[model samples]
Target: MELRHLRYFVAVAAERSMSRAAEQLHLTQPSLSRQIRQLEQELGVVLFERTTTGTALTPGGAAFYHHARLLLRLAEASREAAHSAGEATREVVDLGIPPGLSPDWVVRLLGLLRDEVGRASVLITEANSAEQLRMVREGRLDLGLVHERPLQALTGTRLFSQPFGLAVRPDHPLAARTECTLRELHGLRILAHGREQVQAAHDALIVAAHERGVTPLWRFAQFSEHARSCAEATESDAVVLTENSARRLLPQWPWLRLAEDSVDLTTWLIWQPATRTVVTRVAEVISGLAEPVTVPR
Candidate 1:
């Protein structure tokens, strides 16, 4: 019921053990149990299924867990807003990232921002492109790096757009090929990322098969995870990724190869116009940092 209860609940759910959660919270097991019991009573539902193995969320508990996370994030945001003035003089920016960007890109960009801005606190949030855009629009994030074009409903500055390509393992049969066509991919498997728009794009590719309408087997993955996983595992024959993302992964792995033909995916810096001045400055810093990322043809 209280903020502390939500905090404890989140800890317990995340750790999956009351004792571990208690230890992390610097509380005794008994106190943690009491807090959980009180929380369950207030909610009128059991939030966790306790067993010898550990605590696991029931269906209702799983649903409450999502809301609990959102509440905690909002609480942190509130504190940031309350302490805004003191921190305004300090340069700290929170950047949200969508799928398709390599984690290395994030590391490189964070270092770039810190070196350029000086004395910056950088926070990263990874989500689907749509969700990342929504957070920027909601004023919950200073700026977002998305793997798609800017939405008409939102105003944003362009970062870069890279060509999308079919990614495959080096040893795979398709790796020997120089170029591959969407229609030629009939009966072959492919991995795809994103929600709504990206999903629709993937579906379009599958539906556009010239004949036989062969469905490309899909393995759902979140932001760079899927492409990397499928490529490493050799699970699906290919995965759709931006050229920057492909090149980012290829150097280290060396086994993942890209087909010559590629689609274009754009990365953009999205923000709300009505955002506060401090947040606006943060966005400006991010936009400047991304100025040189070339959009692939």
Candidate 2:
């Protein structure tokens, strides 16, 4: 089958609505529906079924969705490989994002990079703010989203910030609260990221406590590559996290905002002087996506 059929199928599956998918593809609803029907006819399977809420994928459609996405990604990589023929070497941009960054943003970024970076391959790595800063300075990373502004080692742009939230266990006292104050945390064991991952944030928490004369028992860890950190923190009174990180890591837990008066933790997009063209382009796309966001209960 042609690649357009696969592309149309993927888009429809993602949107779960023929009309919305057609709108995104810049085609009429009827045209998009006809294309999908032709694809299903060729495959001899019913791909989508109408549901009360929206279009739902059939069993075959659900299975095909995973393969179709991989095939499209492979197709893009192949084109990039072919386009690098005349060059001495292919360009690859290594980008580092903090653990607290939103997964939705990461997916959006990959899609943007594929469309914008002409002949370069972009790779994403998960690193905390301090690690990202160090990697950017040591030339291990081309771009980084860090929690603090870097010094002489790397140049930085203020992008955005996410306020801290609490992931409290169901049994915890604060679990049902819509928002929490520092004073409420007094005498409770509050789990947080260690200095290795976010020194500035750690210091800010301490300062926030001192300012309010509220002292909660502090427990810290350098979160590993996965959501195991959430599991470990469940033993504590509550785990401090941003909304995005809490949602991505441990969606089952009860999350509430930690609204403090004077605490600030900002994200800075970092890059070295004379960064590559592709690196700057991808960074610009990330910068464009930056805006102050807050999670609603």
Largest TM-score belongs to which candidate? Answer: 2
Cα RMSD (angstroms) for every candidate in the order listed: 10.0, 13.0
Specify the poorest-scoring 10-residue window by lDDT in model 1.
252-261
Model 1: per-residue lDDT, tens digit, 1-297?
A: 799999999999999999999999999999999999999999999999978899999999999999999999999999988887675466556778875565666777777766766666778887767778778777777778776566776668777655556666676776776566665566666666635636544544445543445455655555454456555564677767655666665543222323433444557888776766666766776676554445423
Compute the lDDT for candidate 1.
Answer: 0.70
Model 2, TM vs. native = 0.65
Give the distance in Å from residue 249's predicted Cα in candidate 1 to where it truly belongs.
Answer: 6.1
Report residue 278 deviation for candidate 1 (angstroms).
Answer: 3.2
Residue pairs with colliding backbones in model 2 are: none
TM-score of each: 0.55, 0.65
Model 1 misplaced stretches (Cα beyond 4 Å)? 1-91, 169-171, 194-223, 226-235, 243-261, 289-297
True-vs-predicted CA distance for residue 198, candidate 2, Å = 1.0
Q: Please, what are the lDDT tens digits per residue for candidate 2 over residues 209-271?
A: 878888888887777445446446445777777777777676777888876543556788889
**Residue 232 Cα positional deviation in candidate 1, in Å, after optimal superposition:** 9.1
